[model samples]
Target: MNREERIRSLLDRIRSASLDAHGFVTELELQDFRKNLLVQRGVGMSLLMASECVVQLEAFSPDFVAEHPEIPWAMIRGMRNRMAHGYFDIDLNYVFQTAKHEVPDLVRIVETLLHIHPQGE
Candidate 1:
């Protein structure tokens, strides 16, 4: 696939993962998220997947990534790095907050990006 195609694929992956993460905690409380290992893992893995896609998206072209200043690319990359390097050390609070709030916003941003930047010019 070409660069644009790769970006489109990555955006789709990010959107899917974000949606899954958000859905996992649709009506969940922070205490419940902390208490349930399965839910915690599901959110963590979904965030990780989205972060990994962001990393790949950056790799495809930093310039292309730069064009989209709305996305928190650096923060996403940091999360990916943290998850990849020190999964056990991550704080559940941040994960819960991101899944509950940020992921939904991210899904909307990704959908806009997909619509604006189609597979081909």
Candidate 2:
């Protein structure tokens, strides 16, 4: 893909992943997220997927994110790297918190980007 195409493609992936994670986190409280292994795994995995998209998006062009400070680029990549490199050491609490808090803003910011930049911009 070309630069703009890559950006839009990456943004779409981020949107999909963010929506999934946000949906997963939205339904449960921290108490339930922490107590249930199924919930923990679901939330954690969703976050990991979202974070991976963030990283991949950055790899295409960090400038795409640098221009949009509203998106937590560093935090997103950091979460992905940490989870991918240190799977066992990851804190489920952190994943749940990110899904609950960060993913909403991410979904909004990315959707805005899609409109502001559009395809092939």
Highest-TM-score candidate? 1
Q: After superposition, how far is residue 59 of candidate 1 from its true place, in Å?
A: 0.8
Model 1 CA lDDT for position 82: 90
Candidate 1 lDDT over residue span 1-121, tens digit each: 8777888889999999999999999999999999999999999999999999899889878998999899999999999899788978989999999999888888999999899956667
Worst 10 residues of 1 by lDDT: 112-121
Per-model TM against the reference: 0.94, 0.85
Candidate 2 TM-score, true structure as reference: 0.85
Give the lDDT of residue 19 in candidate 1.
95
Q: Write the per-residue lDDT of candidate 2 for residues 8-121, one digit (tens) a residue.
A: 877888888777877877878888877888766666777777778777777778777778888878877788888878978988778888888877887888898899865544
